[model samples]
Target: MSEVVLTGVVKRYGPVTALDGVDLTVPAGALTAVLGPSGCGKTTLLRCLAGFERLDAGAIRVDGREVAGPGRHMPAHRRRIAVVPQEGALFPHLTVAANISYGLDRADRRGDRVDEVLALVGLAGYGDRMPHQLSGGQQQRVAVARALAPRPSLVLLDEPFSALDAGLRAGLRHDVREALRADGATAVLVTHDQGEALSVADRVVVLRSGRVVQSAAPGTLYREPADQWVAGFVGDAVLLPAVASAGAARTPLGTLPIAGPTTDGPVTVLVRPEQLRLAPASGTDAVTATVLRHDFHGHDALVALRLADDTRVTARVWDSTDPVEVGAEVAVRVDGTVRAWPATPVPAPAAAADPRPVHPVA
Candidate 1:
């Protein structure tokens, strides 16, 4: 296993800068995921770590050994880092066993290493099958097996499951995670899919505009985002302008407790869909809203609503059987403490129309 460290990393192409003074530490024997939108430098970061691209500035070290720095550049082959590309780029003519044994030395090729890696990826008895004969998911498993056969110090997976179906992708993710854990391999995954990053990786690094925005464990990142932009990007958020005093914020949903300390002033409160509770319109203390739409999933449903003041919000209902019809009057109440930030300046048109504004779903 290897711990990779990067400090002040920067890369540029002509007038455009891809990476900008980024510092990150990937722990040993853990899966770290780099997540961001397109053109956010995720691929550039991975290439720098794999020794494929020269760093314009800063240093990269693996296991306390400088691999890329001033007056020194180690080639990709000598870095002991393996990469699994998007498509399963396996040789069509080579059998499963032969593809895995291609990277091993002549002496190691003749040993049982290929069989060991095949078994590790849950394809023990199908070594003689050709690439065309295997399913897409099976082909990806072979790709992973080949990357692991050489016992690399670090493995980089570039959206390996992006091409598969949803069911297949989920299953393959679990299998690959298990295989990496069993081998005690340190891996880095680069993907734009938020769900994949949140579910599979031990640590998630969020990048935006060539800079690191946030890096934390999945649960912490989701529950406590650094700012309103991050809160909206990670999950469904309802942002409301309100006045905060003491420890509560007064909003369209009535008074909601704040998660942490805040000065007495205008604030923007973040309420997750799951935190809002709905019931039949009843008591005077509850805020009433008309259901605009109901989207039902197997496990839960997202109910869109418009308040008496024409502010829209969404609530997640866990009870799938109790259907919420459109145009139904429902009483809304907050279930828990919410995150709050200092209020941002509203746009001129939006501020002129309403003194208190509610942002749409993000």
Candidate 2:
């Protein structure tokens, strides 16, 4: 019955507001990843839901029951929830089965339950083995198995695979998400890895400055973000100068008719590296740029271009395509249409507003 929901949830820590106000809904049996940079309150939000931290204001509900509100706060143990922290946090003194079954309070059905969960996590027959005896990835899998032993309605994973190597992390992410789904357990994963969130989450909730930024499916959030901050956080983006008035956005690509209603004024264009291409010469909007720097990342080559205006941009192209070395002349073209987002109107230094392709991420 636990369909997790949070409305206007806020957490304050000694004059510093950790979570401004967060509203989210995790549908039953679905996995949601809370994604954001460090210190963005993703962990704070998860902790509040896990009943480890008290909320200063707002409501938290599980299974249509209000656990945290104006005057009511539920204790962590009574919340019937499980939290698997980053380091696995396994009990050093206990065997793998003992660690997983430590939370079971009702019955002494530990033997069958432990065996079932172990097999479910692909760690069958490792009951007597101590947590320290297992490999890092195996230990993580054991931790997940332990969280599921008690059969909680929801599982809170705080960067559970952050410590594993890249390859192991990827494999564990898939296996863990599948195991959770197979058990019909709702999960909330808190992580800073964009690829991790995009790959395993049924939906992603992004937070910034203690507030919920954007919440949607992985592809939707990546392709069409709610704002510039969301666009940048969910994936890599290039915000170019553009004009939008009435309905259409006059962009370097072409005049694209508007989708949603937009304010009439100057706006910044948002383009992903995948949406740009290097082509033959064209007119004014087709920028004349010199390939400044490039890097080969196996499947794709990241090419940095310095436009005549001195604006630097990074474009991603397949390695199979022709290579463009540094100092080569190239005309960068916008593949399709780009969205025009209103610029943040706040006073700032000129250098702070400088746009360069600083980070090229997958």
Candidate 3:
């Protein structure tokens, strides 16, 4: 396993900057996920590391070796970084065994190596099958096995599970994560799927536009996002407008304490619906609102509430909530730590000494 590091890494496509000056470090033996909306720089960042694209600026290093920089750009084959892209891109004519074995060095070809990768990827006996003969999930497994065949120190996966159906995707995703961990491989996965990124990565880097927005453990990111963009991008968030007087924000939901880096007079209060609890209005700090619309998703229900002033807030309830019906009055209370005002940009490793504010997530 190897630690992957990038410093001032950048890439541009004509007028569009595919990647800005991004600096990050993926801990050794850790599965790091790059997450963002479509058109963000997530995939470009991965391509720079994989040597699939040349950078206009900055450096990329794997383990302790420089892979890209001034006069030092290494080619993909020589970098020893394996990539499993979205299409799997398996050779149609090659059987699973041949495809996987294609990566094995002549010296390492012995001792059931072919069987080993297939077994590791849960396609043990399917090696003889051609790519077209296998199911989508099976073919994807072969793709993974083929990448791992080289036993590279670093692996990069770009939306590798998109082809599989929902049920199979979930199972195979977990299996693939486990397999990567078992091999002690350092991996970086790039995807737009929040659940996929959250479920597998040891740490997640949420990107926006062409820069890194926030990189944190999944739970920390979900519980307390660095800004509105990271929070909203990863999952559902309820943003409410508020007026700040002193240190507290006054909403129709009563005056709630808002903590932030800077004091902006009028700003938005960001909170997750799960943090809201319903209670009687008179006795609590809760503000009253009327339920407008609600949706029940299996075990959880999302209720959209409109206050007397017409401001809306969404609250998530487990099961069908008896809190209040449509047009019925109810009190809303904030229970967890949430950003009360505009967010300050987070700093990156490249700017560790510079101390300038990083770009905010848009």
Which segments of model 2 are wrong by more than 4 Å?
106-111, 246-259, 280-286, 345-362
C-alpha lDDT of all candidate models, in order: 0.86, 0.80, 0.78
Candidate number achieving the greatest TM-score relative to the actual structure: 1
Each prediction's TM-score versus the true structure: 0.93, 0.89, 0.88
What ranking emerges by lDDT with the best candidate at the front? 1, 2, 3
Q: What is the per-residue lDDT of model 1 for residues 254-349, given as tens digits with 9 covering 90 to 100?
A: 999999778789999899999999999996878999999999998999999999999999999999697898999999999999888898753211
Give the Cα error of residue 286 in candidate 2, in Å. 4.3
Which segments of model 1 are wrong by more than 4 Å? 345-362
lDDT of each residue in 302-349, candidate 2, tens digit only: 888887777778898875366787898888877765666776742221
Q: Pull out the clashing pairs in model 2.
A: none
Taking every candidate in turn, the Cα RMSD to the unseen true structure, in Å, is 7.7, 6.2, 6.4
lDDT of 3 at 261: 57
> How well does candidate 1 match the true structure in TM-score terms?
0.93
Report lDDT (Cα) of residue 259, candidate 3. Answer: 61
